[model samples]
Target: MKKLYSNTLMQLIIALCTFSFVACQEYSIDSQPEGPLNIQIDAQDSYTALATSPSNVVFNISSNTPWTIESDAQWCVPTPSMSASSSLVSEIVVTMENNTGKQSRTAKLTIKAEGISNTKVVTITQASKEDLVVIPYDELVATEGEDITFTIASNKPWEIIPSTAFISNIDKKSGTGNEDAFEETITIKVPANAGARREGTITVKTEFMTYTFTITQNGVVIEQEEDPESTTISVGGTSTGGTVKIRANKEWKVEVPKEYQSWLKAEALSDTELKITTTVNNQLSTRVGHIILKTKEVVDGFEGITFDINQSPAFWFNGSSENRVIDEATGDVKIMAVAGNNVIANYAIKKGHLTFELADINLNGESCLHFNLWPNAGNANIKLWLRSNSDCDFRCAGGFGWGQKMFSLTTEELNAIRTIEFFVEDDPDNIGKLRVRLSINGEEIGNLVNQTNIYETDPSNNPGQVINLQFEGGLNYTEGDYYTVKSITYEPAE
Candidate 1:
């Protein structure tokens, strides 16, 4: 019976033990914690009246925070604060003051719900004021040989005027507080015998302004010439060519146009093209435009020589002796002259003519001669013949019709020496012709065409043009030195 009671009790004990173990395991488990309520605050940027912004100052907080800052403000002043929806909070302000003395302050902000706090330091500095300064403080200038004074019988209190001059000082004073400003005169007086221009200075300073005064006198030395002004004659445009007038008290230099440059090939105009004038004074000065045409080839020259229509050399003869004579060097080359008879330099002979005894010639494949004819006009026939020192003779002797005139002629042949005689059978008009020649060589095997030069019909080659002497030839030799003036003679060829 005892064993049976023990067994029943053991079973009851086993059941009670199992129920207790299950209850312990169930009670030990806990509920999941709410994910952190909100992020905590960390630190903030320092505040400044001089905060160069558009640049952000970041405050690192436990992430997942919705943060925002107050952005409304005036120049360098903070009126609003920064806030966050998270557990932590940060308050800050930007403030400005009198712009002088400066210091820093910090705010200790505690974050609720989160065991965190934030701090923002603010530096306060003095502010700039609008009521200050003296304009362009370079010293004032006073002319010499004169008396200058600064009258300051009235001015602000606590104002001190610094001086770099002898007479700059406190003369009288008035006014008080901010109603303060001064009025005083600094006098600069030149001695009766003051030398030339003199100088001095006055320095002044006040709470609101600072300045320096400059003084001077005339110089002692005398310079009595009026400076020359750069005068210009501007052509309105390429619009029209007309008169351009210039005005000046003194002399001047002006540039001229290209059209006038041809006629007025001059240098250093007394003035320039049209003229420089004074309307008020009616003064006409030698300093006005005086056009002068200068030769372009000043360094070289008008390369070729000039002659009269008649082509006479008499215009070139100027001496103190016989009016007419002969040159021993060029074989009786006539030297007769009566003021203006002229002749061309190089002349060429026509179809039939011969030149002889030409001197000073370099034998340039051609021949030339110079002579003068009687001024009166007339007509006649001239005869020509050829000769050679080498006995190489070729005669194309013929009579050439001509007018009473002196002129140069060119013929073909260096050794083609030609002698021409104008047949003055009856120079009823008392007229004559001067002759010159251009010559070139020839051969029996080759019939070379002789090149010749022609003249213009009218005598209008002056004001606008010149005689264009066209040269022609089979060989076309560039002009050399053979052409020379030898002599002149007359023969009648009816």
Candidate 2:
């Protein structure tokens, strides 16, 4: 009985040991350690940047898990707050705003990763506003042999470097900056330039940054002599005028006749030139005038130089008369009734088509046709047609206060006397083609037609074909809804 009890006790001890080992193995399988929480940051502990301008700080992060970033200051912001786990290194950017504060400031940035107990810290410091340099002007314009003064403010030492030889005698080449916003006055002398305008640059260097500015200098003027006999100036009937060369060494005075003084004017443009001007000469005959130029000294065997100015006459259809009879057969222009029973009258209101043939006028070159008309009441619809030698016809038809392809007029302008002009010339782009334009009251409106093939079909046969201008009143014209043609004029091509 004693041997059997000893064997039973040994078996019970072995079964208890086996059960404890199996329970330990099951606990180890259920609660295994998590993957390694490895993370690294590649950046410095501190950084410095400018205060006046925005600056950026870049760094790299390496991690097996996701990461995030945060900033303590409102001015300092990080681009990405959270990032996924990446095998390759990821870049992070921290942008700092411009610091307008009087003193320098600092910000703290924290970088953290998932499942990590500790975070990386970075400190960023920005300079103060007083630490930056300031330039008031970026460019300077100086005359020949002139001095230019400018100011520079900074709290550091600065230097100026001129890029060209013309810049000389700088008052201050170097200055020590001050903390009280001291402005340093810099004066530079520009030497005389006898030939042409010159340009150069002045580079300013400070402890914080570098800046560049431009310097422009004017050229000198030289005296010249011009012969007055060979210098002849002519102007159109209605033009501002032209210039004439004069001797620069003499003091000159111009004398205009009493009759021509109201229309002619003369002034000195420069020491070597004189500008002559004239008002509009609305007469039919060309006018001639002599401008007597009296100088301080005698020149070319005469006490006073005489310059003859000839102004071309303005073309008129009825010899400058507002009310004139229109001959149906012979004259500079022939008038004929075409559409309605209304006849052409002297300053008369008409409601029919009137064809005016430009007798013996050629349009192969540049020319202008001008006329005055009054739209009696605003209910008249007028059509003006221009035919060049029966080849092509250009038409402009519109009521008053409306826009047309040729021109546009206001209601007030149509009720009063308004001048209408048509200009015909060769097309600049298309060779052998013609271009026509329209104008109202001396202001050019727009082109009527361009690249028009005129006089091309029978150029040899129609060598001197006349231009036909026709006016047609609206078919719905009433008693008072009629337009009147006051005057007609033509300027032949020169």
Candidate 3:
């Protein structure tokens, strides 16, 4: 029985040992690195590709397992391209491409061994590439110094973190299109400062891209200085007139005529070559305004003129041959010219008197009277008479006759209230000497003067009103030889 038991135990033990060995072999086979294909690979962390050079990719394949790399995987270009080496552990090189004017990108790579695979893609960017990114104006044409508002319309699709930039404090806003342009503003000051030129740029970026713009500043340039001072002038004096020299700025416009305009000449040495000067040579009844000097768009030449007032002649004798006439301080008028402000004065006081022996004296109604005066301190004594022809008769018309009427001569001041009269009427029966009374308030001033032959032009026919003195000189003669004037002299009344 013991021997039989020993034989069975041995058989069991052997069978158990064989079973343990098979189990051990099966566990080892199950723990082994198993796959469709398994081979150790030398793939780096982010293999696949880089910006420029090829990224080496090694794939581990199982023994006798077939595998290949995708054709579209390149490391140096934008589009992916690839090439693979032997089985067991296939290796591939990838070249990536540069995208926009932005970053560089590499295609995702996958290694397949017997239908199972894994993939990894990488993108590399270029060195912040940027060109003349035009900064567009909102309005092509605009006014100076207006506000400009905008932002960077970037190139990429995704919203990007703006790149570092510099400009005249531009408020960045929303971008434009897919290839959106950067936004900014430039203000132009006008006239004086605006139209001047200025310069600058625009910049933008994402995780990958950067850009910039060529900046320039531009606007209109205006003037404001035209206020001028007014010219003042005084009457009874002189004034310099013409284009008032506008030292500060702006534009202007002068005429003086005859009267006191004697020797109407401006001094040659005067600095006011563009100005005009005139003098008042005589007196006038009305107030004369300023002496205006007319201006023109261009120069014509010198304009010279003069005027006359009532019969107060304005005589200028600078080079004249008169010894007694003296020049006034005003440098224009002459004193003691011809006895009556106009001629050569007769100073000797001659004794010879003129007598009129008229024939016939007729007036065509015009009474031209002549007078002799005695002036003493603004007071004057006067005698007047009708002038007649040489031959005493009753017919010719060549004479200044004033015998028909009578009037008074009185000064408003000194000679006022003095009554002087000569009473002598035409005699109907005589042709010889006629007696006339020349008296001043019951006193005889002188001999009652008479004329030879002179006719009277009715006072109603005369145009000029004469200041005649009723006080006659000597006695009135008869109508025969007509009343004759013995003399016209400056002798005092006796």
Span of 10 residues, lowest total lDDT, candidate 2 = 361-370
- What does the lDDT read for residue 198 in candidate 2? 64
Could you tell me the lDDT of residue 53 within candidate 2?
75
Per-residue error (Å), model 2, residue 4: 36
Instruction: Give the whole-model CA lDDT for all candidates, comma-separated.
Output: 0.30, 0.55, 0.31
Give the per-residue lDDT digits (tens) of candidate 1, residues 367-406: 2222322111221112222212212221111122332222
Each prediction's total of clashing residue pairs, residues at least 3 apart in sequence or on different chains, is 62, 0, 65
TM-score of each: 0.22, 0.33, 0.25
lDDT, residue 353, candidate 3: 24
Stretches off by above 4 angstroms in model 2 are 1-41, 50-74, 77-95, 102-104, 108-121, 127-147, 154-165, 168-181, 192-494
**Candidate 1, residue 8: lDDT:** 98
Reference-based TM-score, model 3: 0.25
Pairs of residues at least 3 apart in sequence or in different chains that clash in candidate 2: none
lDDT of 3 by residue, 1-494 (tens): 99999999999999977865674364332112233444333444444233333344333232234444454434333222221332322234444343334343434444454444544333333322322233444342232344544344444432222222223444433343243334333332212112223344444544445555444433221111232223332223222232222221112132344443552432222222234343432321112333433332222232321111122222222223442222232222222212122121122111122111221222211122233322212221234443222111111011222222343332221112233344333333445322233443455434432322222332233221112212122433322221111111222121
Q: In angstroms, what RMSD does candidate 2 have relative to the true structure? A: 20.2
lDDT leader: 2
